[model samples]
Target chain A: MSLKVENLSFSYGPRKALDDLSFALAPGSFTALLGPNGAGKSTLFSLLTRLFTAPKGQITIAGHDLGQAPLKALAALGVVFQQPTLDLDLTTRRNLLYYAALHGLRGPAARGLADEALATLSLTDRADTPARNLSGGQRRRVELARALIHRPAVLLLDEPSVGLDAASRRAITDHAHRLADRGTTVLWATHLTDEVGPTDRCLILHRGRLLADAPAGQIAEGTTLTDRFLALTAETA
Target chain B: MTPDPLHLSPNIPQGGPGGGARPPGPAAGRYLTALGAILHRELARFLGQKSRLVAALVRPLVWLLVFAAGFRAALGLSITPPYQTYITYETYILPGLLGMICLFNGMQSSLSLVYDREMGSMRLLLTAPLPRGWLLFAKLLAGTLISLLQCLVFLGIGYAWGIRPPLAGLLAVIPALLLTGLMLGALGLLLSSLIRQLENFAGVMNFVIFPMFFLSSALYPLWKMAEASPALARACALNPFTQAVELIRFSLYLTPNWPALGWTCLATAIFAAAALYGYDPARGFTRAKG
Candidate 1:
């Protein structure tokens, strides 16, 4: 498994945030972590990224234990947090370069990688523009570009397209698919069912519990994925 | 129509000069890289906002040039050890003004944390592959650098007004400013981790900042406080800001107060440790709601 999470559990005092959550993603596979607001998706993302460690769980990213070898595990993963992390005052290229340096890429090599990442996101033209000057979609793309600059084996994205328009959202989702096609294991957390296609694997989480984990096509069957998702979550609600 | 071959090279080494894949060994280089990124980003934020810099400097300048002048005669000059001869109240309060800059900058850094959390940039920083402690340290260092710059600017103005310390004193003052900045910046980090909302931060300033400043030996010497109220004097002596101010005050005269150094170092360690704990992944202070 490129990414494996076993018995992942976390809580905020008495309130449970993730309850025995477990899953695995093969390399080059696209997985969607689908859940509604307050459904523990973000909490799970936090744990997976080791933003905070889960008390009872084992998370292995690219064969490295997350707890014992956090830096190594994290180095193999690229993350696009739900919040935009770019420095608004700095140009897009500068923002990417900053992230590049964080992953230990420096000098001309860092610059070249930053350029390639920007080009991958089709953001080369806007490289010199300050983040504040970019549109919401453009800024989101810049964020994606920054995450990919390090080229980790596993990519974790939390709500990468929360507030974008339909066109932008499709563009981002397509980009994620392309990344998987390029052999990166992707775990994309989001609420929108349409974002997950028939072939994609789906993990439905509700109230801090894994409700279902199966192929998207099988879960949808004859009906649409959105209707099935609402039915599954609403039943628990 | 063509498809690129799937590349699965586990043999890829880690820490190459530049590559998409993670290198083989421990990612020691990430520490410097994360530090560099956070520092660069924070410096941009600190300098890009010209208005904030102007306001930060102007606030202390007004306190030193105007408020100190108005209250100059009321406060008699004392020939303290740091003061070779009779010194005006304005000159006496200059160090305190520098302390004020660090205090306000520290709180301002917390404000940025709250803003970043709300805006989601903080999540980005926290999720990076580097250790969270180093990331916070980098942020503290950046804040210190900015505070030092502001202090230097304020000192430049003081020199123009003929309130000059020995030229050598300025060099000694750098380490003093750094210590003060780190201590206060750590306190700001602790506050930022604890407080969830920007509105709640107002209470921090009122409850924490004002009391720490007023009760400390910033404006008045501990000896004066001893005369006025012995209990208050003890409190002032123990207050961390008192040590910071005393450190800056003595350093400006090329004097080293070991007690002040000890207290400042202890305070810095405690504050930084608490900040690290507060932001720790397992027991950090972030609310479940976010």
Candidate 2:
């Protein structure tokens, strides 16, 4: 497994946010972590990203154990958090360069990677534009470019498509699939069913446990992913 | 599974900051790059927010201009070690007000940390292949640098306002100002880690900043406090902030106060370590929720 979570459990005091959840993603796989607002998907991402630690479980990213070698694990991982993380005053290229430097790239090499990332996202023209001046979708794309600047092997995006228009949503979802196809392991967390294509892998989570883990078409009892997701969550309730 | 070399993008340039074959973990070169990047971002942002610079300078200016004029006749100072002859009350309180600049700026830095943590920007920072301690230290250093810049501005304003120290005194106070800034920045780092949320800064401002500033010898000398109450004098003397102010005060007159330096450095080290422990992931630190 390129991205692995084993027996992960978390809580806010006594109330469990995640309970014995376990899952893995193979290389080149794009798995939509489908869950409702309270379903602990963010908790799982927090654990995976080492923003928060789980007492009971282990997280390994591209063979590096998070507990034992966090730098190595994090080196292989790229994250697009649910919230907008860009410094509003900085240009798009500046944000990517900053991220690249954080990952050990610098000077000419860092600039090259920044150019490549911006070019990959078709944001080259907007590279010098301040983040606040950009549209919501453009800013999100800038964030995506920032994540890619260091070329992390495993990408984790929590609700990356949220707050985006329909066209922007498709562009992001399509770009994520393209990255997966290029052999980067991706775990995209979102509640929207339409974001997950029929061919992509899926994981349905409720409360704390993963209720379904299969292809999007395989869940829902031969129905649409939205219906299947609703039914599985309702059944758990 | 190890990260496949083939999976590494061709767009990735060959050499990292280390200038040779890449290591799998955080390297010293990586640390410096990240630190520089963080500092650059901070300076860039700080420059963009021109009002912050004005706000940081204005508080002390008000005190120096208005309050100092009001209290000029009220407070009289004996010729201290740094002061060979009689000095105005404004001259006596210059270093104290500089300390105030750092104190507020440090807290402002920490408040941004809390806000960043709440807004999820801090998560982006922490996800880097770096130790949390180093990152926190980088943040402290950045805030300290900004505080130093503000101190320079305040000192320039002071010189213009006829509160000029000796030329040598101005040069001598840089190290003292730096040490004091670090100590206060570290203290702010500690508080930001312990404080529950961003909303609690109001309490920090009133309860922490006010009490520390007033209880120290910032506004008045410890001797003045002694004249009022021995207990208050003891509190003023015992305050670490008092030590910081004294260090700056003596340095501004080109004198060294060994005890003050010792206390400020010790306090800085202690606060920094506590902040590191507070932010350690093994402790299962709080994750800002939606």
Candidate 3:
């Protein structure tokens, strides 16, 4: 497993956020974490990325224990936060280069990686343009490009498509899928069921507990994934 | 069971910061890189809004040129370390004006953190692969760099107005500015992580900033406060801003106040630690919805 989380638990004071959650993803697999609002997806992402440490469980990224060897584990993971992370005043290329530098990529290597990542996102033409001038989709793509500049083995995105238009959302998801296809383990957190296909692995979470983890095809046997999701969460409610 | 058909490529091992070919020491190099990125972003943001630079400069300039003019006679200036003889009130308050610039910039940086949280960019920053402490420190360093630039510009303007410090004093002022900048920047980081909403920040500025500036030894000497009220003098002496102001005032005269430096360093450490704790995922302020 490229990413392994076991018995993960977290809380915000009195309210438990993630409850004994355990999951694992192969080196080159895409997993969708499906849940409604307040289902602890964000908290889970925070724990996985080591934004906060969980004393109750363990998280290992690319064979490195997150708690013990945070830098190594973090170095193996790339994260796309729900918020737009790019500096709006900087050109897209500059933003990527900045992120690249953070991971110790400098000189020609950093420039080359920034260029390649921008090209991968079809944003090479917009490299010189400030991020603020880009459309919502373009900006999000630029963020994705920045995340990939380090070429991390594990990519964790927290609700990457929230405010994006349908076409843009589709493009972002497709791009993620392509990245996963190329061996980057991806944990995509979202509530939209349509974004997950039947063949994809899916985990349903509700009120900070894992309700089910199965193939999307099996979970949504007869009805739509959305319908099944609503039914499952409603049953627990 | 059917095989999971979606095959991603093999995990490509890429060199990360302080990893690969880089020799490891204290990880300062990695932190410097992160700090560089954050500083670049901050500078870009400050420069992008053409109004911000003007506003930052204009506020202190008005206080120096106009407000100081009105009070020049009412406030009698004595020979101070930075002042040779009986100087105008305007000249005496130049360091205070510089302090004010740093104070405002620090608070403004905090305000923007709240704005960033609301806008979602903060989330991106928080989730970066680096340690949260390093991230927050990077932010502090960035804010300090900007504040330092503003102080330099303000000093240049002061020179234009015929308020000249010792030529050697300019060299000494850099370290002073850096210390003041870090202290204020740390306070700003603490506020940024603590204050969840932009609306509530105004209350902070009203209650904390105004009092800190007005009651501090910024506009007047501690001895002056003592003449008015011993209690007020004590308060001014204890105020961290007073320490910052004193540090700058002495350094601008090429003098070092060891006590002031100690106080500023202590305050900076406390504030920076609090900010880090506030952003800590375990027990910090991130749990509350921004």
Q: What digit string (tens of lDDT, one per residue) describes model 2 on residues B1-290?
A: 32221122224333221112233454788899899999998988898889989988899999999999899998888887778999898988899999999999889988998899887788888888899888888899899999999999899989998988989988899999899889989989888888778888899989889999999988898888999999989988889999999999999988889999999999999998888888877563455462
- lDDT of residue B155 for candidate 3: 91
* Stronger candidate by TM-score (1 vs 3): 1
lDDT of 1 by residue, B163-245 (tens): 89999998899999999999999999999989988889889979989999999978887888899899999999889999999
User: i-RMS values of the candidates, in order?
Assistant: 7.1, 7.9, 6.7
Model 3: how far is A76 from its true place, Å?
A: 1.1
Candidate numbers sorted by lDDT from highest down: 2, 1, 3
Q: What is the lDDT, from 0 to 100, of the residue B111 in candidate 3?
A: 91
What class would a CAPRI assessor give candidate 2's docking? acceptable
Model 3: per-residue lDDT, tens digit, B1-290? 22221221223234331123232455666667777878877887777787888899999899899999899878876676656678887777888888898899889888988888777677666765578888887888888888888888889999999988887887798888888888888888888878878899988889878998988877888887899999989988999999998889888887778999899999999988888878887766666762
lDDT of 2 by residue, A1-237 (tens): 788989888887788999998898898789999999989988888888887787888898888999999988888888898999998888888888888888888888789778877777778888899888998888888888787777777888999988887766876877788788777888999999999988788998899998989889878567888988888899889
On residues A39-127, what C-alpha lDDT tens digit does candidate 3 reach at each position? 99988887786656787999999899988888788877788888777777778988888777677566787788788777777777899
Q: How accurate is candidate 3 locally (lDDT)?
A: 0.81
Report how far off residue B24 is in candidate 2 (Å): 9.8
TM-score of each: 0.94, 0.94, 0.91
When 1 and 2 are scored with lDDT, the better candidate is 2
Ranking by DockQ: 1, 2, 3
